[model samples]
Each structure stands twice: as structure tokens, then as C-alpha cells.
Target chain A: MKRLREVFLSALMLENPLMRLMIGLCSALAISTRVESTLFMGMAATFVLVCSNTIISLSRKVIPDEVRIPVFIVVIASFVTIVDLVMRAYFPPIYARLGVWIPLIVVNCIILGRAEAFASKNDVLASVADGLGMGGGYTIVLLIMGTFRELVGTGKIVMFERTLVSLGSTFQPPTIVVLFPGAFFTFGFLMAILNKLENRWWGK
Target chain B: MMEAARTYLLLFFGAAIVYNILLIRFIGLCPFFGVSKSIETSIGMSVAVLFVMTVATSACWLLWGLVLQPLGVGEFLYIPSFILVIAALVQFEEMFIRKVSPPLYKAMGIYLPLITTNCAVLAVAVESVKPGFLKLNIPYHYSLPEAVVYAIGVACGFAVAIVMFAAIRERIELAPIAKSLRGAPIGFITAGLMSLAFMGFAGLFKL
Candidate 1:
């Protein structure tokens, strides 16, 4: 029980993929401009991560040590293709928004890095837990970013083309919040805050 | 003849400054922040990206056109096929570099292997096949040569942005900045400002 808890929680907070490791920032920064898109993107990534991790962990022994990297990439790319096709067939709108990003998930270092680092060495159950935990952490960050960007950029929260909440008409929306510069500013500040929180938590 | 020249020129300048892969598209953020600390390392990474990106793009395009299309498996097999080509290309590059130029290989170090997964490299491959988003200023489908030209343009753009960022970061290291904004935070903020500056160059050319 303790091991399972640690395996899961470490991915969320202690060893967060983006905040702490900073491996996967491209998709995080790009698809996070809107909450609805982020939600879909995060779920797609989680599906890929979970499925790929489980498969990789299960086949770790059979994969040749010399060709492991290519093997892992094939597994990941196959899963990404599944996500891409499913999202396109079911949710065309979100699929259009995501576009290249969905396919780019195949190259997301977090998935490949985990497959190489953890899944290759761990049991199937632990790999699944790790995937879920990391995926949860990634999704949480995306939700925060999407909320902040949407609220500040457009002065409202939207989901599936419906307005969830609005900051009222009097609020002046800053256009930067929705642009490339805004992504950098928001990401930098979030990293700073996370750094401070971690410092305080560790008393360092 | 004249039209092709104009398109090539437009793509070169446009991708290099206006729609930079690193700053604008946000395709290769990992190395943009990871290797931009030093101009030397950044230059090395830039060269590595340039080589791998151009080769990977051309190779994937050829695979799609020659192999996948004829075989009628281009739709579902693109993901696995493109990745295999990229991985193989990276390995080939490593071996070719070691044999031809040992010093360059040592300089590149581990970054070459990392190129296989670089989104920018993958972006080049995927975008070459799908034509709408990149807006290469070409009229119809991308030919093999056109793909190579666009790949070189994007790679050069990546090199220019990364090296420029590295030079700025080297100077930022000397400046006395705030405690919290010293490292990656300041780097990102500076990149944001650069991105804003690049935005000014948008719409300068119609093509």
C-alpha cells in the first residue's frame, strides 16, 4: 500500500513531469490556451500514457536491449494514432483545435522517458499507477493554465462552446493572455510559484 | 522559374523570423530552454537540429510518397513508419558523423539521440505530408525538393532563434537580476519579449 501510494503521489507532486522535470512543455504551453481543448488534450495524453506504459512494461523482457528505444517509440506512436483517430471520429471540433499536437504526442518526452526509465524496470501494475499519476499531474497543470489563460485572456470560462462563467462586461481582457508571450509569462510565473512552494515544503 | 525562386526566398525569411519553430510555433521548447544557456552548446544543438531535421523531413516525405503511397498503407502506418525512419536516420547520422568527423560527434554528444524525439523534427515530417498549416507558399502539393527546402528553412529558423537566444542569455548571465528570476524564469520572459518583437515582423510579406 505504501509503495503504491508513493509511486502514484511522486508523479503528481514530487516528481511532476512538467513542473519539476520540465520534459514536456511544448504541448502544455500550446494546447492550454482554452480549457475545453486542454481537457480533451489532457485526457488524450492520459489515455496514451496509460496504455503505452502498460504495454511497454508488459513487454519489457521480450524487447531487445539494443533496440528498446525504437520499440518504445513504435508502441507510443501506435497509441497516439489511436487517440488521433478516435478523437477525430468522435470529437471533430476538439480534434481540429488540437491538429498537429495530437500526433506530436508521439514525441512527448514524458512518455518515452518514463518508458525508458521506469516502465522498463517496473512491474505492469506499478507502471500503470505511474502513468496515471503523471497524467493526473499533467492534467492538473493544464487545467490551471487553461483557466488562467481563458479567464484573463477572454474574461470568461468556456467549455464545449458554452460559457461556464464570466468576469462580467466591465472586465478588460488582456490580449496577451491568449498569445505566445502570455504563455511564456504564465508558465514562468507558475514555475516560480512552484519553486517557492517546494522550497517551503522542504525547509530548504 | 521565377515563381519557385520567390517562394523559396519567402519561405527562408518567413520561417526564419516570422514563424520561427522555436519562438512562434513552440515546437522545440525543450532544447530552446535546455541548451540555450551557453552559445557554444546552443550552436552545437542548432547544427544537430539542422542536419537531423532536413534529413528526417526529406526521408519521411520520400517514404510517404514512394513506399507508403504505393503500398496503400500511408494512412494508419504513417505514425510508426515516420518514427522508424527518424530513429534510423538519427542512428545513421551518429555513425556517419563518427566515421567522418569524430570531433563534431563529440561536440554534439547526447543531443543527436535526443533529436529523434524532438517535436520540431517530427513536426517537419508530419507537416510535410499535411500541407495546410505550414503555409509553405507553394501552390499545390509539396514535391520532394519543396519539402527539403521547407525543412532547411525551418531548421535554419530554429538555428537562428536558438543561437540568438543563447547570445542574449549569455549577456543576461552578467546582468544582476532578481533572485527568483535569475535562471529559467528570466530566460522564458526574455523569450516572450523576443516573441513579441517577432510578432512585429508578421504580415511584412504577403506570401
Candidate 2:
């Protein structure tokens, strides 16, 4: 239990996929323009990551060394396709907004990286903890970014067509905050703050 | 004949400049920052992507058209099948290069395998077949050659953006930048500026 806790906690902060490792920034930046879509994308990615990590951990012993990468890709890609089709069938708007990004999750290094690094070496339960923690960390960062972008860019945060938060129409929202440059700007500042906090707390 | 040439030209410039895979579209950014520290590695990665993307896109196109379309399972199986094809293609290219061109394989190092996961390559593979995305003033499905050409254009676009960014970043390394902004923060800012510059070319291929 302690080991599981450690694994989960480490993924949340110490080994945060986006903030620390920077393995999965592409989708994080692209889909984060809207808070709702970001949440959906995060959940979809977490589901895939958790399922793939568990399966990979379970079958790690039986899988051949030569084709392990391909095996991991197959597992990850299948989950992503499931998410893609389900989203298309159920949540067409978010799926359309996400566009190619939903399918592109197959190449997301975080999933493959965890499968190769942690899952392949660890037990199934430990891998599950790691997957959940990492997925949670990813989702947290996405929500933070999405909040900033949605609030600043459009003066409000709307999820499922409902306004969760709004700064009023009189507030002049800078449209740039939701564009590509704004993503870079927001990511850089957040990363710097995270870096400073880590340094202060851990004394690098 | 003249119409085809114009379309190809428009496609090349459109992909390369207007919608650069790296800066503008935000695909293939992992290596864009990771391996783009030096011009040499940038060039090497660019070439590797160029070769792999062309072959992978063509193979994916053919697979989609011939196998997936016939089986009527293209919708469900595309992600896995395309990924498998890319992985297999990378493996084949690795073996072929090791046997046929040892030095080149040694030079490419890790970027070759990394191509399998580069979203830009996969994006090209998926987009080139989408009827709406690939309409190069042609109102139909992309032919094999057209798909291959567009892939080459996108790869070239990636190459151009990365090489340019590398050159700028090399200079940036010399400049006395601030503490926190030295590495990736500055890199992101620089890329943002470059992206803005690319936005200037957005109206180039306007129909």
C-alpha cells in the first residue's frame, strides 16, 4: 500500500507528465483552448492510459522482447480508437472540436513511456496506481491551462454549454490568450512557477 | 497539365509555410524542441521524417483504400492498422538502412524510431486521406501520387520550420537571456514569434 501510494503521488507531482517530463504537450496545448473540451480530452486520455498500463503490466511477462514496442502501440491504439468511436457516436461536438487530436493520442509519448518504463517492470496493481496518478496529473495541468485560456480568451468558462464561471461581457478578453501563442505563454509561466516551487520545496 | 502543376505548387507552399507542421499546427513538437538544438540533428531528423512520412502516408493510403475499404472495417481498425503499418515501416527502414547504408543508419540514431510516434507523421497519414482536408482544388479523393506529394510537402514544411528554428535557437544560446527564460520558455516565445511570422503567409494560397 505504501509503495502504491508512493507511485501514485510521485506521478502527480514529482513525475508529472506535462509539467515535469513534457512528454505530452501537443494535445495539451491544442485541446486546451476550451475548458470543457480539455476535460473531455483529459478523461479520454486517462481511460486509455489506465487500461493500457494495466494490460501491459499483466502481459509483460508473456510478451516477447523484440516486439514489445509494437505490442504497446497496438494496445494504446486500440484504446484510442475506442475512445474516438465512442466520442463520435455520443459527443460529436467535442469530438469534432478535438478533430485529429483524439486519434493522435496513439502517438502520445506518455502512454508509451509509462508502458515501457513502469508497467513493463512493475506489478499490475502498482502500474494501475502509476497510471491513475499520471493521468490525474495530466488532467490537473490541462484544467489549469484550460481555465486560464477560457477565462482570459472569452471572459468565461463554459462546460457542456453551461456557464460555470463568467467575468461579465464588459470585460474585454484578450483573444490571444486562447490562441497558439497564449498556449506557449501560459505553459511557460506555469512551468516556471512549478520549477520555482519545486526548487524551494526540494532545494535543488 | 498546367492545372496539376499549379495545384502541386500551391499544396507544397501551403503545407510548408501556411500550415507548418511544427510551429503553426503544433504537431511533431517533441522533437522540434528535443532534437532541434543543433542544425545537424535538425537536418537529420528532417530527412528521416521526410523519408518515413512519404512511405508511411503512401502505405497508409493504399492500406486504407485496398484492404480497409474492402473489409469495411476501416472506421474501427484505422488507428491500430495505421500505427502498426508505421511501426513496421520504421522497422523495415531500420533494417534496410543498417544493411544497405550503415553510416546513414548510424547517423539517424534514435530519430528514426521516434518518427513512429511523431504526431505530425500520423497526422499527415490521417489527413491526406480525409476528403475535406486533402482537397487541393480537386473535388475528389486523393490519388496515390497526390497523397505522396502532399506528404512530401508536409515533410518539407516540417524540415523548413525546424531548420529555421534551430538556426535561431543556436543564436539564442549565445544571447544573454534571463535565468528562467533561458531554455524552453525562451524557446516557446521564439517559436511563438515564428508562428506569428508564419501566420503572415496564411493568405498565400487563398483560392
Candidate 3:
């Protein structure tokens, strides 16, 4: 139990896939313009990561070393396909919004990186814990960026066509916050903050 | 003839500049940051991407039109099949290059495997077959010629962005900077500024 907790916590903070490891940023930046879309994207990615990590952990011994990358890709791709079809069927609007990013998840380094670095070497339970932790870390960063971007870009937060938080008409939004560069700026500042916190706490 | 040439040019620039695969569209950013630390490696990555993207996109285009679409499994099968195609193509290209031309392989060999997981290659492959995702001003479905042109343009755009960013990053390395934002954070901020510059090209040519 203690070991699993360590694995999980490390992924969440010490070795975040986005902030520290820097493995997956393509989809994170592209879809983080809106809180709703970021939430869904994070969920879809976490689902794929957990499932793929478990399967890869289970079959780690059987997969030959020479062909492991291909095998890992095949496993990850299958799960991404499952997520894609289900989303397209149930949520057409999101499916349309996410567009190519859904399929692009197949190549996301977070899943494959976890598979190669952690899952293949660890037990199933540990792998699952790591997946959740990494996914949570990725999602948290996405949410932070999403909320900031949406609020400042549009001056409010709307989910399901309802306004959740409105700064009112007096608050003029900076439209750039919702654009492509805003993604970089948000991620950069947030990453810097995380680094500052880590340094302050650990003295490293 | 002139009209067709103009259309092709529009598709090319539309993918390359206005919607750059790296700085603008946010695809294949892993390499954009990973390999852009040095101009040499970034150039190597650029060549590998250019070669593989065009070939991979063409191959996937053929597979979609020839097999998947005919069988009506394209809707669901595309994700898996396209990924497998890319993975296999990268391996095969690596071997083919080694056996056929040693010197050529030496230049691009290191980056070949890396391209498999690069989202830009896969994104280009999928977008070429399934249009409308990119929202380009071109037509709905891409013919072979158009797809090739677009892929080349995207690869070139990627090359331009990474190489340019690499040069900037090289200079950035020497600049005095905050310890926390020294590496990736500063990279992202610099990329953001560059992206802001690219945004200036949004409506150019009105393609």
C-alpha cells in the first residue's frame, strides 16, 4: 500500500508527464482553450493510459524485446480507437470539437512513455497506480490552463451552454488567452510556478 | 491548368504557413521542443519528417481509398490501422534506407524511429485522407497530387519552424534567465512569442 501511494504521488507531483517529464504537450495545448473540452480530453487520455498500462504490464514478459515498441503501440492504439468510437457516438459535439486530436492520442508519448519506462518493469497494481497519477497530473495541468484561458479569454466560464462564472461585461477579455500562443504562455507560467514551489519545498 | 496549379499552391501554403504543424496547429510539439535544442539535430529531424511524412501520408491515403473505405470499416478502423501503418512504415523505411544508401541513412537514421510517435506525421496522414479537420480553404477530399503537395508543405513548415526555433533557442541558452524557467518553461514562452508572430500570417494570400 505504501509503495503504491509513493508511485502515485510521484507521478502527480515529482515526475509529472507534462510539467517535469515533458512527454505529451501536443493535445494538451491544443484542446485546453475551454474547460469542458479539456475535461473530456483528460478523461479520454486517462482512460487510454490506465487501460494500456494494465495490459502492457500484464503482457510485459511475453512481448519480445525487439518488437516491444510496436506491440506497445498496437495496444495503445486499440484503446484510443475504443475511446474515439464511443465519444463519436455519444457526444457528437465534442467529437467534432476534438476532431483529429482524438485519433492523434494514439501517438501521445505519455501512454507510450509510461508503458516503456514504468509499466513493463512493474507489477499490474503499481502500473495502474502510476497511470492514475500521471493521468491526474496531466489533467490537473490541463484544467489549470483551461480555466485560466477560458476565464481571461472569454471573461467567464460556460459549461453545457450555461455560464458558470462571469466577470460581467465590465471585464474585457484578452482574446489571445484563448488562441494558440495563449496555450504556450499559460503552460510556461504554470510550469515556472511549479518549479518554484518544488524548489522552495525541497531546496533543490 | 493554371487554376489547378493555383489550387495546389493554396493547399500547400495553407498547411505549411497559415496552419503550421508545429507553432500554429500544435501538432508534433514533442519534437519541436525535444530536438530543437540544437540546430543540427533539428535539421536532421526536419529531413526525416519530410521524407517520412510524404511517404506515410501517401501510403495511408492508398490504404484508406483502396482497402478501408471499400470495406466500410474506415470510420472505426482508421485510428488503429493508420497508427499501425505509421509504425510499420517507420521500421521499414529505416531498413530500406540502410540497405539502399549508407550515407543517406547515416544522416536520417537516428530520427526515423522517433518519427513514428511524432503526432505531426500521423496527423498529416489522417488529415490527408479525412479532410475537413484542418478547415483549409481547399476542397473536401484530397487527390493524390494534392495530398503529396500538402504533406510536403507541412513538412517544410515543420522544418522552418523547428530550425528557426532552434536558432533562437541556441541564442536563448546564452541569455541570463531565471533558474526555474531556464529549460522547457522558457522554451514554451519563446514558442508562444513565435506563435504570436506566425499568427500574423493568418490571412495572407487569402487562401
Candidate 4:
């Protein structure tokens, strides 16, 4: 339990991918523009990350060193395909919004990085803990970004049928939030803000 | 033939400047952020990208038109075809570079492999296949050569943007900025500004 707590805390703070390591900024920047899209993307990524890590951890010893990266990519690509197909079949609307991004997930360094770094080397239990911790951290970052970008872009956060978040009705959607520059600027600004907050909370 | 030449030129310039393979399109960012810090390295990497992207676009166009679409595997062919084309393109680029320009190849050494997964190169193929991205109405039954031209043009757009950003970043380094704004902050700012600037090209030459 203590170890699990440590993993969770570290993922949120010390080893945060977006904040500290900056491993998964690609998807983070792309999907954070809308709340619903972020929610869908975050769930899809978490599912892949958790399941892929578990499978990789289980099959670690059987795989040869030379063929590891290829196998890892194959595994990731398969999971991404699964997510892509299922979403297209069942959740067609969200699937439309996240069409190429789901496939793009195969290249998302977070899943592959976790598979190599923590999962392959660790036990199943530890891998699960790592996955949950990291996934939560990623989700939180996405949620915050989604809230900001959506609320700023469209002046409301509409997630599927649920209008769970709203900044203000009067706030006009900043046209920039919907564009590419908005993604870049938001990422840089938010990173700085997070860094500042982290430093203030626990400083040198 | 005149129309073909005109379309090709339009595609090339549009992808490079107005659409910009990197800043506006969100493709080819792996190398953009990775190697843009150094001018010589960025130039070498960009030139390498220009070569592979042009080839990958052309090859994938052929594969898609000649093989994949005909076999009733249009939708599913994307990922598999992409990987195959990218793998082959990387190998070809590696061999060509080593043979033609030894020093440049040596400079780009490992970054060449990084191009295999570069989103920009992948994006060029993806976008060109779609008419709107390339800003061209190539009709439903477009030929392989047409696809090749579209892809090359988009990749060239990527080459143009990266080379431009690479040049800009060189000067940015010389300017005395705060420590936090040194590398990534400036890059982000440049990208943000470029994206903003590129918006002016919207509907300038619509599909």
C-alpha cells in the first residue's frame, strides 16, 4: 500500500510525464483542445497503457532483446487498432473527433516508454500500480487542459451529453484555442505555471 | 500537361509556406523540436527529411493506388502501408545519403532513423491522400503520379517550414534571453507565431 501510494504520488509530482519528464506532450497538446475529446482520448490511452504494460510485463522474459522494440510496437499498434475500431463502431461521434489521433496513439511515447521502463522490468502488480499511477497523472493533466482550452475556446466544456464544466457563458471563445498556435502556447504557458506551482509548494 | 505543371507548383509552394508541413499541420514535430536547436544539424536533418518525405509520399501513393485500394483494403491499409513505406524509405534514404554525402550522413547519424516515425512525413502521406489538406481536387479516380506530386509537395512544405524554423532558431540563440526562454520556450513562441501567421493563407487557394 505504501509502495502504491509512493508510485501514485511520484507520478503526480516528481515523475509527472507532462510536467517533469515531458514524455507525452504530443498527444497532450493535440487532444487538450476539447473536454469530450480529452476525456475519450484519456480513457483510450489509459486502457492501452494499462493493458499493454500488463501484457509486456507478463511476456518480458520470452522476448529476445533484438526483437523487443518491434514486438513492443506491434503490441501497441494492435491495442490502438482495437481502440480505434471499437470507438468507430460503438462511439462513432467521439471516434470522428479522434479519428487519426487514435492511430497516432501507437506513436505516443508514453505507452511505449512505460512498457520499456517500468513494465517490462517489473512484476505484474508493480506494473499495474505504475500504469494506474501514470494514467491518473496523465488524465488529470488532460482534464485540466481540457477544462481550460474548451472553456476558453468555446466558453463551455461539453463532454458528450454532459455539460459538466463551464467557465462562463459570456466569455467568447478565443479563436486561437481552436487553432495550432493555441496548442503550442497553452502547452508552454501551462508547463511554466505548473513548474511555478510545484516550486512554490515544494521548493529548493 | 499545363494544368498538371501548375497544380504541382501550387502544391509545392502551398505545402511549404501557406499550409506549412510543421507549424500549421502539426506533422513532423519529432524532428522540429528535437534538432531545431542547432542550425547545421537542423539543415542536415531537414534536407534528409525533404528527401525521405518526398520518396515516402511517392512510394505510398503508388502502393495505395496500385495495390491497396484495388484490393478492397482502403481503410485498413493506412497503418500497415505507412510502416512498410516508412521502413523502406528510411533504408533507401540511409543508403543514398551514405553514398552521396558521407559527412552530411555522419552528421545526421542517428537522427535519420528518427525520421522513420516523424509525424510530418507520415502526415504528408495522410494529408495528400485527402484532397482538402493538399488543397487540390484531384477527382475520385486520380492516378498514381498525381498522388506522388501531392505527397511530394506536402513534404516539401514540411521541408520549407523546418528549414525556415531552423534558420530562425539560429538567430534566436544569439539573442540574450532568460534561461527558461532559451530553448523550448522560444521554439514554442516561434511556432505559435508561425501558426498565427499561416492563418492568413487560409482560402488563399482553396481546394
Can you list the residue pairs that collide in candidate 1? none
Question: Residue B70's C-alpha lDDT in candidate 2?
Answer: 92
Over B115-141, each residue of candidate 4 has an lDDT whose tens digit, in order, gives: 766666666666556332234333343
Tens-digit per-residue lDDT, B68-184, candidate 1: 989998878988889888889889888988899787788767777888888999888888886444454443567788778888889898988898999999899999986666688
Candidate 3 lDDT by residue in tens digits, A1-204: 999999999999889899888888999999999999999999999999999999999999999999999899889989998998899899989888889899988999999989999999999999999999999999999999899999999999999789999999999999999999999999999989988988999999
Q: TM-scores of the models, in the given order? A: 0.96, 0.95, 0.96, 0.86
Q: Per DockQ, what order, best first?
A: 3, 1, 2, 4
Ten contiguous residues with the weakest lDDT in model 2 chain A? A190-199
Candidate 1 lDDT, A155-193, residue by residue in tens: 999897789999999999998988888888888888877
Determine the C-alpha RMSD for candidate 2 after optimal superposition of all C-alphas.
2.0
Across residues B1-207, which tens digit of lDDT does each residue of candidate 3 receive? Answer: 999999888888888899988988899998898878788878878887898899899999999999999999998888888888888888887887789878767765445687899999999889888865765744378888988999999999999999999999999999999999988899999999999999999979786
TM-score of decoy 2: 0.95
lDDT of 3: 0.90
Better DockQ candidate (2, 3)? 3
Interface Cα RMSD, each model: 1.2, 1.7, 0.9, 2.7
- Could you report the Cα RMSD, in angstroms, for every candidate shown? 1.7, 2.0, 1.8, 3.2
lDDT of 4 by residue, A160-185 (tens): 67887676667677878867788888
